[model samples]
Each structure stands twice: as structure tokens, then as C-alpha cells.
Target chain A: MSTTIKVARPVDWTGIFFAVVLTLVIVVPLLVVGTWAFTNVWRFPSVIPQEFGLKFWYQTLARADVWSSITMSLTLATTVTLISAVICLPAAYAFARMDFPGRDILFFSFLAGHAFPKFGLLVAIAGIFLQLNLIGTFWGVVLIQLVGTLLFMIWIPVAAFQSVDRRMEEAARDVGASPFRVFWSITLPQAGPTIAAALLLSFVGTFYETEGAWLIGAPQVRTLPVLMISFINNQPVIQYGAVLSVLLWVPSFIALLFARRVVNSGSFAKGFGA
Target chain B: MSVLTIKDVTKLFPGGTKAVDSFSLEVADGELVCLLGPSGSGKSTLLRMVGGFETPSAGLIAIDGEDITRMPPEKRPTGMVFQSHALWTHMDVFKNLAFGLKLRRLPATEIKRKVEAVLELVGLGGYGSRRVTQLSGGQQQRVALARSLVLEPKILLLDEPFASLDQHLRERLREEVRDIQQRVGITTLFVTHGQDEALSMADRIVVMRDGGTEQIDRPDVVYRNPQTPFVAGFIGTMNLLEGTVANGIFTRASFSHPLAVADGPATLAIRPEALDVTPAEPGAAKVHRVTDYGTHGLLDLDLPDDTRLKAMVSHPAQYRHGMGVNLTPRAVSAYRNNAQIFRSEA
Candidate 1:
């Protein structure tokens, strides 16, 4: 099938080749940083490290801030995940199913916020939190991350709920089931895999994100990304930032490996939208 | 008693499309009435309004003389079997049937017995534990039936319920549905575009078109005597010939058929089977085309003018070359009820 399908144009070939080069260039740097975390030293401008040991890993654990950073990252991600699910489920349903005045305007406003980078809101958001005396609270870090989490995660579930057949709900209503019962039984069960995928994506994505956490959060509420940055600044010669990167990415990576079902169903439900 | 009454009910959707315009019907208890129409003819919208899935823009609906115009579907004593089965895909057959009962908080023992009995009634006794998708299309449809039957609705409504099944399966399931309807004797209102389905299964057929009732008659009466040109054209395959009526006898274009019109100019309609091939006589027609349809041949007879009349004849054993065929239309019907027929503008 592949051989006889069609002749490839030069433009298509160049596009494919350029994409592969770009992916390799970006991924290889992250791969090196990951491998360097376990090795003893980076000798020169060589592709591979000369000395390999776990001295940096042991010394990085010796600092108590490593544990605090792990806890901070976990807490901020968990809180963001809970808030996103609670706030976004109803919002997504309202956007998908109901019709009111200014509905399209409201939806487009959400899309605008989603398009705007989180860094644009960082300084003003920090100032607001400081004035409210919530700067040192763990919940403060979560509030700073809330806007992006709702935009990105709610879009997935909104598309999921809309793809469901309205006839199914009508059929349930015809068979003596109330509207709420139909929503609970037929609608939500079908949306299970998408919700799970969105929850995982929001939590894991926020865990590794540095911009929101680094700018708005105070010193006492430092997340793993902020902690990792401070650790690198204090021990520039030790290269513990590389260790912290691997440490931070491992849990999220494992969660993602088992997330194929969630992604497959979420992507299928989220057709032509997110 | 009138089990269901739709009195002056009208549904005006957005943009002024009157889906069901001032429609009304009084279905007697235990009668199976089929609302028959082509798509976009407001048959389904009427059914939806009755089921409360749609709120009518005008008029009122009553079940057993109680007005339920604004009542939600679940609150009404009505159940509907959807065309696609609409079985709870995530649930097993057992839970699917017992869903409404469980929601109403029926006792577990009564729910168990009712579910078991209906499942057996639908010939899916052992399929209770199986997922709805795991079942065949026929089985899933039976599950839908069981789900609605468990509710014991005063009148059961079906929206092209067996349409998704194959021809043979649909025939068998409609027979099953009829038998169950007879045994339980609940009033039923089913909708279908297929004439054969409505004719064979319904106690009374309501033919709808252009948001109004075209004809409401029994199957045999409707087939033998159609009330309007649209009903005749839509219900079944009819060989129509354009003719004019003056005095009493109708003057067809080619051959003058002995049709009796009531008042003014008219059009006469004849079923293909009404005309038969006879031995060629002085005023008879000559055969133009013959289509052999297994046991019978559908022949088109050319008259003096270019007007060709259709006839259905059983294949004779000795049909040979140069054998001339005659035409005879017996016990046929004529309509001059409206001048629209001769206009030919519609």
C-alpha cells in the first residue's frame, strides 16, 4: 500500500526531513541533561560524559530542600487538578450544551485567555496575591496556576460532552429517566476516559511548569521548579539542576506511559476542537 | 375510550417551519396506530411532541383525558422505543431493563421478577448479564422493547423502532411487537415511513404530508381506495394516467375508461392489478413493453394516442409471438374531488 500509494513531492520530503531534524535537535538536549544527572562530571564539549557516578544524586538528596520541593510540586499540582475538575466540568457542560445571550462571546473569551501565555499575567497576579496576604500560602501558588489549568483542561471535557449524542439523552428521557439521571448514567459514563485523561494532563503538566510557580509564588510556597532553579544557582559547580530535572520528570513520565488509553479516548472525544 | 388525544396541537420551530400544524387524533385504548409519512413531513416532530422531548409552540395534548402538554416525558405515563435501540451501552441487559424501576425505587424482588419475565418475553432470558453492544442488532432492539415495557406505560410510542433491522428481522420483530401488544393490550402509537410496515402492523394508519393529515383509514381501504393524489402517489406504486372528466364518463387521453366522477373535471386513479390483459378486441390496446417479474409480467399497453396504460397479469402458459393483448380496468376508483388534478401544476 505504501509503495504504490503516490509519488512524494519534493516539498513534502523537505517538510518531513526538517521536522525530524527539529525534533532530534530539541529532544537530544533534554536527553543529555537527563543522562548527566547520574554521571559524575561533564569533561568537555563531547557528546557523552567521560565520568559516570551517583555522587551528585546522593549530595542533592542530602539537602533538605529536595523533599520540600517534591512536596510543593505535588501539592500545587493536586490542588490545581481538584480545582480544575470542580470548576471546569460545569463550565464545559454549559459551554457545550446551553444557549444564552452572549454565549459565543463568553466562549471566545475563554479561548483568548487560553491563547495568551501565562507569563503575561504573572506580575499582576503576584501583586494581587500579595495585596490579599495569600503570597506565602500553598493555595496561593494554585490560584496563580488556575487560569491556565481551566482553559486547557476544560476545553477537552467541553468537546467530549458535545460529541455525545443528544438522542441518547432523549431516549433516556423517553424511557422514564429524568434529565439528571440521564446525565449521570449515559453521559458521564461515556465521558469517563476523557475526564481521566484531562485530569492527568492538567496535574502532570502543571507539575513540570516553572513560569507560573517561579513568578507569583513567594519563597515559603516554592514549588519544585522554583526549588530546582535555586538549587542550581547555589551549587552551580555541582550540576544538581540536571538531577532535579530527572527527579521532577520521573513520576509524570511514568503516569504518561500508562496514559495511552486516556489520550486515545480523550483525543477521539475531542475531535476538531482541542 | 380515547387513550390519547392530540387536540389542535401545533409545533412551530424556529424560522416559521410548522412541523406539526394543528394536528389531532383520538386513539382508542389497545389500538395500534401508525403515523406514516416521508421524512420532513412532520411525522416525527408530532411523535416528539407527544413524548415531551419537544415542547409544542401551540395547542395541547392529553393522555386519557388529562392534559399533559407541559409535563416532562419521564413524568408522563408514556414510553418510547428509539430507532437505534438507545440501549444503555455501558449497562448489562438486566440493568438496562430494570433501570426505570430502580430509579423509581421499586423493591428488589419485584424488579428482579419483572426484569426476568420481560427478558424471557423478548427471548433474551440468558442475555441479562451481557453488555448491550455484545448483543446482535435484533437482540438490542428487544432489550429496548423490554426497557419500555417494564415501565408499563399507558401508551407505548415507537419511533421507527425496527427500521435499523434487516427486512426479515424487521418482519419478525414487528410480528413479535404485535403479539405482545395484543396480549397486554396497551395502546401503541408507532411511526414509520415504510408503507408496508404501517399497512401490515397498524390497526389504523395515519398518512401525513405537509404538516397535515392526508388520510386516516384502515390498510385495505386505503390501498384499494386512496383519498388524494398525493396519498396514492406516496403510499404505493400506482400507474397514474392523466385524464379529464366532462358530463359523467371520464375521458382518458388515449382510451376512454368508464370512470364515474362526482361533479366537475377530474383525474381517475387505477391500481396496476385493477387492469388485466384480455384477448385483443376492436377497442383494445396493443402491448408496448413487458417486464417479467418472476410469476407475473407488468405490461404497458399502448392505446390509440401516446397514452400508455399499465397492467399486471400472471404469466400465461401459452404466451406466443404475435399474440395481441387487451386491457380492462375493473372495480377502479375516480376522483374529481379537486380541480388540482387536471391542472398538472403541482
Candidate 2:
């Protein structure tokens, strides 16, 4: 009779304690916010909900304030993802496969944005958005996000495309494939997961963006985070104020699932080697 | 007329690296020519020019008398295989075999028939449906051949195709490639840094160095009567002696007796196998070391002036190191080309 032996992996209890405690720190507030949205009468000193009702949710849904903001944010994120994809594929291919002028300078310039704070661009970008007659419009918000967002999207796929063996492309050309066919059939499919990851991360970046929304989305375009702030600032300081926080997290959950599939595929893992 | 004419092709890189300077050769139709050289010898760059991956900076490359110097790679009637079999990873073996045919817009039925025929020919009879990633390394290489051969291009270019494989596989695949090229009667150009691969497969061999042709001849002609010293040294290991030749006798730098020589101040090159090692009947050198490499043993010996000469011998038990042995050069040919590498440089 054969028996199987289980091997034990050592655990770090102190590290685990901090990890669990920190996770609870983030999660406890989130759950409390969801609970607080329903409780009608509440006091911090009481430490327990006195009532529960769907009134806040009902009111928030009916006002058209939250819905319009959600729609606006989705529209803005979609625009940025689509536009960023256009700039990313060709730029990534050129950087990865072709030898062109300003290659290093161009690549580092894209990375330079991530080095500095995105908020630093708010004042200058707001002024430019205003000058371009882009304030309070979906395109206006898209224009501002495109600068910061595209740098990351390009970085991920550039590495992905480069990670595919260059000899493969040379072989394609040797087999009578034109440069375009080689890219379509050989290089692109190999880098599929990396492109997907880039898109998901780009989508997430646009979805949670508040500064661009708050700065340029004034007067007409009010995104989700902006509207959430407005509703929380409503008179009486109701305990239902925390419900707006739930709205902020919904799209992030969707993005997390999307990013999981892309990141786990082996194709994207090659991007690190490049 | 030559099937391909490379007229004085010179390749100078932008950074002033003379990769293939004024190099030229003619490959007749249906001839398997191996461009043989060591690494950085400009053999690969010369092959690329023929495949249309590279354009010569200053010469005309004509395929079957038609100048293709300016044509793009796709338009050229040539097929190339690499050191690594560059199979399309996304496509199945059948799809990969059919891709070039599909690009030419052949009908789907015709594509299927053609792909099946090629798969059978390459010994992948039941592998048309498998993805390239699923196949073994050797299988992937076979698919790469099927992919290129299906197009039936006028010329086939292989750049060290078996260099990526182990020795056993390399030997088997080289034979397979030779057999296939012969069956198709396609003009093929094989490039390699290995002398054995070139010797075994090529109908004719073009030895290149420093961006120019060193020698172009049948394998035997190049071996027996190497026109230049570099060809003799690079093609196979040869014992070179610095000597001055006068009337078929060479006066070596180390020895007093006048040895075999060319007409003037000459370099002496002798193959190891050409030097016979045996019990002395007349004149011989003493064996310094007997290296037995299973199949044969190489006897390292010193001549009159302490200059060493190596001979491939058999039977490790026949002789011991430090024993006095005789040398009789069974074959000696005096070649007097200006490209003869200096004895010192060798």
C-alpha cells in the first residue's frame, strides 16, 4: 500500500498578523460604509444601527444624479481606453521591433509621467482643457487622462511584443510573409495577454480617476466620484452618507476580475523579461 | 548562365563594418552550395543578401538573370530557414503549411491537398492538425521545411538550420534537408560555421572571410588543392609550417633539410590524415601524444626543428606516447595564392 506524505510550508506569524490586521483595516471601513447606507438613525457613540431602510438607495437612484455620474464616468473611461489602444499598438510595435529616431528619449518620456505625480498636471491641464474649449465634456476629460494613461498602456505591450522571439518574425519574412502579415499572425497573437492586461489596467485607471473628473468635469460633466462627493455633502449629514462610497467601488470590482484573467495568462508574464 | 549571379557585392554597415566587401559567387541551377565560414566571417550576411533580407550597398544580385537587388523580400523568389525553426506559433501545422499558399490566394481545396502532400513528404503524415507548440523540436523543424517547400520558390536559403540542434539531430536533419532539396531539384544555398556540415552536404562550397570569397570549388577540389592558406586552415585543422620553397623542396624555419616548397617564399600546409604514422621504414617524427577519440586517435609529433604535426591514426593500443614514429605525407599539393594566411598569423 502506497501512502502520500504532505509537506508543510513555514509560515510567518508576525507578518501574517500585520497582513490580516491591515486587510481588516481596509475591509472593515468598506463593510461599515455599506451598512451605514441603510441605517436611518445612527450615532457613533451608540456603535450600533438603530434602524434599516432602502430609502437612501431609493433616493439616490431616483434623483438621476448618481445615474448620470455613473454614465458619464463609463463613457469617459471607454473613450480613454479606445483612444489609448490606437496610440498603444503602433507605438509599442515601433518601440519593440523597429529602429527609429528618438527611440530611447521617446520611451523614457512616456515613463517620466509615472515618475511624477498625476495631480501635478491638474492646474496646467485644467487651464489647457479650458483653453481648448474641452471643460465639462466627455472628450475634455478623455484628453486629460490620455496623457497619463497611454504611457502605462504602451509600456506593458511594448515589453510584451518585444518578448516574442525576433527570429520568429525573421522566419515569417523568410517564408514570404510581408511585414504586416508577420505582425498580424506572429507578433500580435503572442502578445495577446499583455495587450489585454494593458487594457484592463487602463480601464481601471480611467474608472477611478477623480482629479480629472473633479477638475475638468465641472459645470456640465459630473462623473461618479464628483457626484458621490456632492451627495455626501448634502444637508443634515445623514448616516446614509456612506452609501456614495459603495458606488465608488463597484466598477473596480469588475476591473479586478478582468485584470485577473489577463495577468494570469503566460503571454503577459513574458513582458517582464523584455 | 548561372541561376544566381552575385556581382561584386560589398556590404559596408553604417558604422563602417565591412561585413561582406566585394564578395561574389555563382550558383548554378539545381546545385546545393554551402557558404562555409567561421563566425564573423561574413558568410551569413552574404546569405541574407541572396535571400533579399539585406540589400548590398554596392553590387547587383540577379536571380536567374533578373536583377532582384531592389525587390522586397516577399517579391523575391527565395525561401529561407533559420538556425531556429521560425514556425508560426498561432497556426496549426496544417494552417502553417497552407499560409503561403493562402497568401497567394490558392483555393481552399487546393491548399488542403497541397498541405497534406507536403506533410506526408516531411514524415509528418498525421500531424497537420497539431499546433506548432505541441510538436517536438525536431517536428517543429520539419514543419518549417514543409512551410517553405510548399511555395516551390526558385531558390532555398538555410542559415545554419541545424545549428540549434544537438549533434545527433543535426546529422540526421542535415541528411533529411539534403535529400529533400535533391528531390525537389531546387537551387539551394546552405550557410554554416561548421566544416563537417558543409563537407557532407554541399555539391559545391563557397568559403568566405572578411567580406570576400576565399575559395569556390567542389568539396574535394577545395580540400585537396586549397588555393589559399585560409581555406586550408579554416576548412579542416591543418599543420602549418613557415618555410621557403625552391623547386618542390621547402626549407622550413626550424629544420636544416630542405622540405617541400612552392616556387618562392612559401607557406607549407599539410592535413593531419595526409601525414602517415607507422613503424619507421625511412624518415619519421617521434610521437608526442596519442589522443584517442573513440573512432580514431590523433598522433601529435614533432618534426626536425621541434615544429609539431598531427596525424589521425587508429588503434589506441598500437602506439604509445613518446615513441619514435615515421611520417610519410601520402598527398602533398603546393598551392600558391596571395591569400595564403601567414604562418605566423596561423
Instruction: For all candidates in order, state the fraction of native interface contacts they contain.
Output: 0.72, 0.74
Candidate 1, DockQ to 2 decimals?
0.65
lDDT of candidate 1 over A41-156, digit per residue (tens): 67788767888889988988888888878888898898899988888887877887899899777766766655766576777777887899877787777887777676657777
Task: After the best TM-score superposition of candidate 1, give how far the Cα of residue B93 lies from its true spot, in angstroms.
Answer: 1.8
Clashes of each: 0, 6
**Could you give candidate 1's per-residue lDDT for residues B1-346 as a string of tens digits?**
3399998889998899999889989899999999999998899998888899899888888998899999999898898889987877778889888888988899999999999998888778888899888899999999998898888899899999989999999999999999988888889999999998999899999999978998899987677667887777777777666677666556765466554445456666677777766766444576667778888877777766767777787984434333466666674655555323321111
Q: Which residue pairs in candidate 1 have backbone atoms (N, alpha carbon, C) closer than 3 angstroms, thus clashing?
A: none
> Candidate 2, B45: how far from true, in Å?
1.1
Model 1 DockQ class: medium
CA lDDT of every candidate? 0.79, 0.79
Best by TM-score: 1
DockQ for each candidate? 0.65, 0.65
